[model samples]
Target: MTPARFAGVLSAAVTLGVAAACSDGGSPVDPGGCAADLTTGIAAYDLDGLDVHAVLPTSTSSCIVANADSHFVAVDPSAQPSGRLFVFLPGSAARARNYRKIAFAAARAGYPAIVLTYVNDLPVGVRCAFGTGDCYEEVRREIITGVDASSRLTVGPDDAIEGRLVHLLTAMESLDPGSGWSTFHDGASPRWDRISVAGHSQGGGHSLFLSRETTVFRATAYSSAGDLEPLSATPVPWLDGSWATPAERIGGFISEDDEVVSPSGAIAAWTRIGLDDFGGPVSVDDTAAPWAGARMLTTRAPPRNAGAVFTPHHGVTVVDGLTPLELDGAPTFGPVWAALSFPGS
Candidate 1:
């Protein structure tokens, strides 16, 4: 979905920060039952996922302290009557905004997406001067710190943090019209038959860890690099310390030329993603030289008439910038959407 198309639906009062699917030639499936004005141009209700909610971590640990303002947004957007869940943990505030486009686009396509807005809750004076290269390191440190209790930075993990992350998908399964108004829902009750977690930059690292650590998540989609040399100080393994099984459902989107996450680590990870039947090679390789030993899902440049589609731009703009509508036609989501369309891939 493009931003313009998304803005068109602003007539309805769905909540912010988090935001899919359907068959052909049918009336759009909006759980909210929006007015015709709001649903117009929706183009067959290609999507229908919920905004769910957000979570704020309260830990005082160095990682959490450095990232006290960060939050997580959880979503569920599988094809079943009872859908699957996906969590988006963007490393930066800008990255979070970028996912909003993806979330809305997915929602338009009928998949529920959650755009985490934890940055909005950050302390006013906080600032990181590092460029993209160091940014990843800084973000990684913060994430590790956030999860580690022994770190010098110390704070309490708000009890709600875990629940909020889990509830987005849980709520999707037991969705009732009245549920939308509730601020609290018990995620533990939901049957998470299939869960895929994804993120960008630092978020991607977290997604990798979450997918590996959580038995409930069936697959994961991480963007950028192969893998970082394991953190020097931390005992927690990168990806999952316990050596979680190769993700039966692991895939990532790598820009042939992404500077933020060097394609190398991402390619290396594909070696693992390919071990299982559905695990291998769902990667959308943008470079001419595909990752060795990995199946590549290559994309041709957008048709001349269609203007340029798909570029190195980060987040949802990777999709939204291509379309005519403010949000209806984002192409950034094409790859992720395509992956989701396939079952057990």
Candidate 2:
């Protein structure tokens, strides 16, 4: 389904729910019900083979985190576990429930996936818009660890992105002792080496930022490059910093016609991180699966244009309603998701 149209499905899921078929009229099968946690507006999907659960951050900790209504955990028992978890972050102000399709796709591919709810109400660029040196890194540090590094915002440690992941896994381990979720975290810290990170828009930038903090299994970005300073249009200083994850292990997808963020600018940021050294991004539209074995990827798919109410092309690569869909209601970019977020190349 297109990302622009997913919202309509969500609103209807609140009311019609199981009674509703795919609102975009692409799927022939009737869904039994909405994906887990309808009150939080997870889209109606074929959840038959997946064990999906909505976890509130507060369900595991006393701190009330952002997007508390729809933190999701998905696993498909039918698939062989890859022994790694896929962690996803939503764009600024976007809800976690809206991203279950991708998470479910990761789960079906045999990775435990969580669409985390972290503090992302403000864009990282906005927070660092006019700051003194590399405020981009400082804001990301504050958000991830809840340290008072940037003067713009204060994220508490318990409410920090790292802390919330630890809490979620700790709670999940307690809920299902045999699931082996405990391997990703101990009581205190996340075993960053055991996790793969992916995100859309602001979440995409944060994913790369997280990769810098620790050695994640892999890093994938969708519809995102790092934040650009508005005036000069130059990338923030942190994009050129020392990264723990190598460029070869990093992969990403972006829209050629992204309206919200410049596609060339996005590629420039990726180049700054050395993604262009192995190979420049190949077009997912013209190229077949594996996309010539390139780590960086792009698509020529156009965004949904609804007269006066338009969805940005920036979201065409993932969600926000512009992502293309197959006739069976699966995202056309499913292969891209697997190639990027899967356990290894």
Determine which window of 10 residues in candidate 1 has minimal summed lDDT: 35-44
- Per-candidate TM-scores read 0.51, 0.83
lDDT of 1 by residue, 148-206 (tens): 32232322222222333332333222222322312222323222234444555545554
lDDT of 2 at 121: 88
Question: Residue-wise lDDT of candidate 2 within 195-285, one digit each (tens)?
Answer: 8889998999888887776788888888888677776657778888788988877887898877667778788888888888867589988
**Could you give me the TM-score of model 1 versus the true structure?**
0.51
- Displacement of residue 274 (Cα, Å) in model 2 is 1.3
